[model samples]
Target: MLRVGKKTAEDTQTPNNEIESSVTEWSEKVTSLLWLINADHILPQSYVPEGLENLPNSNVQVVEEAGRAFVRMTQNMDEPLYVANGYISATAQQNLYESKRQQYLEEGYTEERASMVIVDEYFPGGADEHQLGLTFDVCTDAALNLDVDFGLTPQGQWLEEHAWEYGFIFRGAEGAPKIYKPWQLRYVGETHAAIMEKLHLSLDEYLAYLEDKGTSYFSDVGAMHLDLIVYFTDSLSEIPLKIREVSGDNNGHYIVVCYR
Candidate 1:
């Protein structure tokens, strides 16, 4: 079983303080396009991703790659889908958390109970995926409200089935410790997305699998063969040159997608 919760000190080195070594040189694949942000592996309050682009026909914005994939995904959908929330700032997340907690308290819940309830649905400042600019809450015209039942709707069901094809994943699904958020979609790029879908793994589970295996994972999709190699090391020197792309797992490892 995959362990869930905050990362321990042993799981990852502190941000920006990666251990330097003379073993190898770093590659340019260490970009924001593949950051994995979550409750445990949070982004800093002042951290802002580069190349943020507004989603066409929507007020929300996401990372450039995600925005492009979202546009393509929306175009392929039969029904109209809308982006309800995206690119939340750390301050905004703090406000949202406080507001929800206060609302619960006003409804006669104790302070502790209110806090517990809020944690189930809201992420604290600097610990939310929205800050990464690669996550968005989507909705349909008929169901503008977010609720578990949304998963049963046509639009929601369609997204669950095909979002991965466009590099998106239905985050915080059932069985995961977090609340079921059928409307929330996170972009991790097409390669990782496809591999996760094929393995039927959540982002957390998939990353854990990569870390544990420490070997190249191969998957055959149609006529194309995808190879992914994961490395857990404190120094960039541990990475090999055969790596075509590299992405931080946000927990303490680098995932290298190999190309022929």
Candidate 2:
């Protein structure tokens, strides 16, 4: 337990009597997750450091999940006192982050900072998800993942606003899956991206689709997607978008009316 606050076990028990009562008053289930920033030329100092560090902002993250606030330790593997090791992304994500930051700086946001993975960064065991390069810890940057419509920032709004534009999807958002971290983003490839864009399903709905439905579900989905595209596109009527249906129902390439 990160001990974001105090845990009580019925004032009757002595402090030593309730030494193992773990509870968070701020943890809440959300529909968000984070993308770990990575870079090639620059190796980020592993926030995962010496055994059991309890530093916020730089050391560990105080994420508010499941309505109760809990601390997610950002420490090394050998002495991991966390249920999950923050994800360390590949060099590609790092590059993307830096590039985006530079762009934002050019505009106004100077809060972007590159982070993740240190040389010999250790994790206790159990082949943590971060070890596989499949997970990433979200930073507090208000500007992230500009290329993806489903950006990881409040300024960008929820994935429902822009996820399909990029070749990514939210793990859960529609009528499926338990609402988890809303910041979590998953790369589902261009085809799925196009279809998702066309269908307008949030990350959650898409995952639900994969688990319960079949690829054959795409045909019907395609039509629904077409309608959404038309609706939003029309809303942007002032700015003409090159709405190109590069392919048919089978081809998952949707020529979006790119404003830029």
Candidate 3:
């Protein structure tokens, strides 16, 4: 885990100035579509998405771009897909998490054990991607109630294979810190999604890979002739002019997408 401790005067001074300078230099870059929101990195309780919209056939809301892509992706699927959850408010998340935790406690688990068990499937309040309005829990049948068995279903398999093509990714799975939630998808935009799928990297791994590579790391997605340039810097002055789109890893770096 990346531990950020409290900064002393000297530690804060230089880094603060550098960040200010970087922010000023990259003021035109805009907030990224690929922002990473997870348990370790959280959204504020007041953080409502700017483009929330109702998904076409569901009452659940998602950011506009992701909603559009989701609609298209679902339409192309051979089987029906159901939107089970999206855009949960911090309060609602808190309530649900607390309720579940209490249920676990009533079942005789200790407080710590209850929290651990609950978090294995649900994030507490602000520590979830659902608050970002760019995530959705989908299932082949709404009645299945989001069990691990969904991962074995045809709809889940289809999404695992094709969700990235529409800028979504299976956000959590086994072998990771979080529970395996095959039904949840987070939209990180098509360029990054495609690269992540091709390289077989999780979002966390992909972000770390970008940071290690530093600036000047670029790749081409062969068939589309798409150029991906990754920049990890305190400033964005070095970003290329032909940039088609920009996404932040939300961990102090930018990914620029361009076409050849």
Model 3 lDDT per residue over 1-260, tens place: 67488867776344555656654545575555667776777778888888899988678998898999999998998898888888999889989989999999999999999977887767777887788888888877767376677778898888888888898888766222556777778888787788888889887787777777775444665347466666655445554444566666667766655444
Q: What is the lDDT of candidate 2?
A: 0.32
Off by over 4 Å in 2: 1-134, 142-153, 158-160, 172-179, 197-260
- Best prediction by lDDT: 3
Tens digits of per-residue lDDT for model 1, 144-202:
56666767878888988898888888785721256777778888888778888888988
Ten-residue segment with the worst summed lDDT in candidate 2? 22-31
Order of quality (lDDT): 3, 1, 2
Candidate 2, residues 121-160, lDDT tens digits: the string is 2222221223223232343343432222323444225333
**Candidates in descending TM-score order:** 3, 1, 2
Model 3: pairs clashing at backbone N, Cα or C within 3 Å: none
lDDT at residue 171 of model 3 (Cα atoms): 77
TM-score (C-alpha, index-matched) for candidate 1: 0.81
TM-score per prediction, in order, is 0.81, 0.27, 0.81
